[model samples]
Target: MDNISRRGLLTGVGALLAAGSLGVSTASARSLALPASKRFKMSATTNEFFRHKPLWGPRVMQSFAFDTPNNRLFAGQLRSETPENSGDLTLSQLDFSGNVLGHMYLTGFGHAVSIGAEAVGSTSYIWTETDADTTNGRGRQITRFPWQNGKTLTSASVTKWKPVSGASVYTPAVDQRFGRLGVRHARSDGMYINVYSLAAARTGDFSTVLASFKQPALTAGIDFQGWALYGSYCYFWEGEAYPGEPDETKATSKLWCYDINAGVLVDSFLTLAGKSLTYREPEGMAVYGSTDGTARLYFGFASGEPGDRRANLFYRNTLV
Candidate 1:
């Protein structure tokens, strides 16, 4: 292996060793074998935010259907400020090399909520959004836009915005179907998975799927956000707040994965192996394909022993 691959393998091994030292148990420690091309290279845009003012930071990202064919990546930027004051939500296009190519601003929406993209036709894509206001408790509707040319996109036409009944509005991730949208609400009890038909966007029709297992009782100050879908599974990392107690029994962190279709927990992996890594706050995850066709998941943690600002990425072989 070359220097880069060697470094990556060593990092993975180190992480496992650290976990072991901390008494973290789950998967056996093994060096990650990464394809040379699949090794992650830090981008110039690696910082928390782009060139924009206030630097709200880039939170979540999803791809447009035409991205692979056209060599483009469409992602939404979640602004750190509130929507009423900031009125910021940005949609950007990036090249395969992680260079920003094109971008547009979204107005009226409080914060650019969650983003989902689907192929409506041969070369057409439908992008959807959901706001992040909890007080309203009403989920916004879906908006459709066509991504065309290298740096041009058609105007967004609002198609659906409806209040979700009998459910508190929360940030949601969506998977599109031909006639409906499968939305999973990350809730305390577990993921509240719901399927909303496209035609019923204004009505917010939903079929709920509850977590197969009981929700763990977490200590106060431990923020438990729901899981994020990567491939066919959803991964969730639960961590404690800052100034966190070091007592592992009182405050601990873990990563769990559940099969999407089966709604069952396949496995739970502890982020801290043997206490080598003390997690402060963990948030957001993404998956990308390595050059050799292997897939890896990247997670971002807010704070830890390394530092609150330090962000670490981890990869595991795709089970699917």
Candidate 2:
């Protein structure tokens, strides 16, 4: 974090304090700039199997994470259009430019809600919610995969347990620099963020909660779509999509970039309104940047309508 962003964060905190309480409002502080014209697009077809389907399933690229050291993008896909049929999960590997390199089909899981990817040298770790259903049974767990030659997926023994039930768990973000895992989800009141030590979480030791805060920006019943943590900032995303019907005019883009280190929001803005038509429901996020303060943010949107079920990835080059 630079002096400029640090000051911005402090100023935002002071404003919230003076205002008495944090409410559902935009950060009246700095605003993020429009994404650069240099953009890339990939369709559900990139995974090959999903290309010919008339209506792409509900969870097409539901979660996203960037492996900084390996320069690979990991995307988690739920093949079922509805929760009742939620069982099949696929993990796709791609490059920064939206090219699918290879993919692996993940099985032996029940209702995978979200996925977080982290890479340390040749070993890769993925955190996700498993055995969770629309009715009951949900738990957070991590898996280890070592890829030096052939592709293989193995499960790790989760020795600890701290269960959060019945809430829609969005994507989790791993902070490699700090060895922390950040997770967010929706409840009856608002959204809650949980930051856990990566070292402890890997061993299923989720005892000490580093930072737990409520995001008043979301009201009760509002859906938490996607989020990511990079450097000292955390980017949150959601959209306004009319149920069943595809209306680009009614669809909206809700995005907020917060500085977790300073405990304040840095930027808030909305885009992609009546523009792409297919860019609705922002469900996944990934940030590729450094601590010195420069990043390219990527968002994955899943389509609901049949005609618009094509490519669904968007990017913004600037941080704020």
Candidate 3:
């Protein structure tokens, strides 16, 4: 544990910190057991249009999606969170008031992390890439950019990443709801639910919607990070890698709920414990709406312990 004690335990848990606009509590927000201490008032006001000054520092932001008609918010930053940094895919674009409209650098690719975008038809916008380096064979590709001049609508193609039939293993996670482009792969052993067919304009075809299940028991860790698609169900999180046993118990975690249209697997939330405590790795997942809009399922755990500085936003509040 060197690197200055793992960056002083990721700067005492605030690893790459940023928060400033908190008021999270609308009473029973939507129920999934919402009482973890209800209090969400955070404000440092650093949304400087999605700030990015680190040329080489806190870069572990594996996945992020939200490009509602250019209102922007498309992140996939990685340089070190291992998985060989998955080819260091660094694509950025932020604007829903968080401005930073451009940022790109995609090399041959390795940890292209998981990303899935949609807007296919009235103009076109399809982005998909999931290869959290399950040693690399976990390569499931999908690329078609052109929301408005981003170009390569179907020239930067890639679609050979397969594994989705009766089931066996098709690891893919990082869903963004209704705008559509969901994924959570694994079968022949457990956990499965694939959705990606931007009207089938063609791009590594995927539309199994749901498969293999008998009860919440899907486990295949490391790269199936936070996934969400409330309402019909599809909330995911799984992690397992105790290899050398130090990097936070080699990373151990779990949280599942899939019914994305009745695919099955009601609930399972064994976050982390009794094996050497470790829950600091459950990347990006957000759901909060209810003024009558209804939406709950806030997740973003990433703690390295030591000094615990904040980054454990877990909330279920109803998805049953």
Top lDDT model = 2
Task: Please tell me which model should have the higher lDDT, number 1 or number 2.
Answer: 2
TM-score of 3: 0.27
- Model 3 scores worst on lDDT over the 10 consecutive residues at 1-10
Candidate 2 local accuracy as lDDT?
Answer: 0.49
When summed lDDT is taken over every stretch of 10 residues in candidate 1, the lowest stretch is 1-10
Per model, state how many residue pairs clash.
11, 1, 22
List residue ranges in candidate 2 displaced over 4 A: 1-59, 80-85, 108-113, 134-171, 185-190, 219-222, 242-251, 261-266, 303-308
Which candidate leads in TM-score?
2
1-320: candidate 3 lDDT, tens digit per residue: 10111111111123112211112222221112211112111111111112222222145445555543333455554434343423445555554443446665544343333454544344434354443333432334434455443322221343434435443223233333333344444443333345553344245445333222221334421344545553345555545333222354344465655443333444555553323324345455544433213334544433343323112344444322
lDDT of 2 by residue, 214-309 (tens): 543431223445677654566666554444445545545666666554455545555553244443455566665444244456666665453334
Q: Is candidate 2 or candidate 3 better by lDDT?
A: 2
lDDT, candidate 1, 1-320, per-residue tens: 00001111111212222221112222221111111122222111122321111111343221222222233445554333333323245565555433556666554333333344444444535344444233432234435556543342222334444323433333334333123343533333332434444445424444333222222222223344333444344555455433443565554556666444443455655454223333334443444442325444444443333211322334454443
Query: Please, what is the whole-model Cα lDDT of each candidate in the order they appear?
Result: 0.37, 0.49, 0.39
After TM-score superposition, what is the CA distance of residue 320 in candidate 3 from its true location, in Å?
A: 18
> How does each model score on TM-score?
0.50, 0.65, 0.27
Order by TM-score, highest first: 2, 1, 3
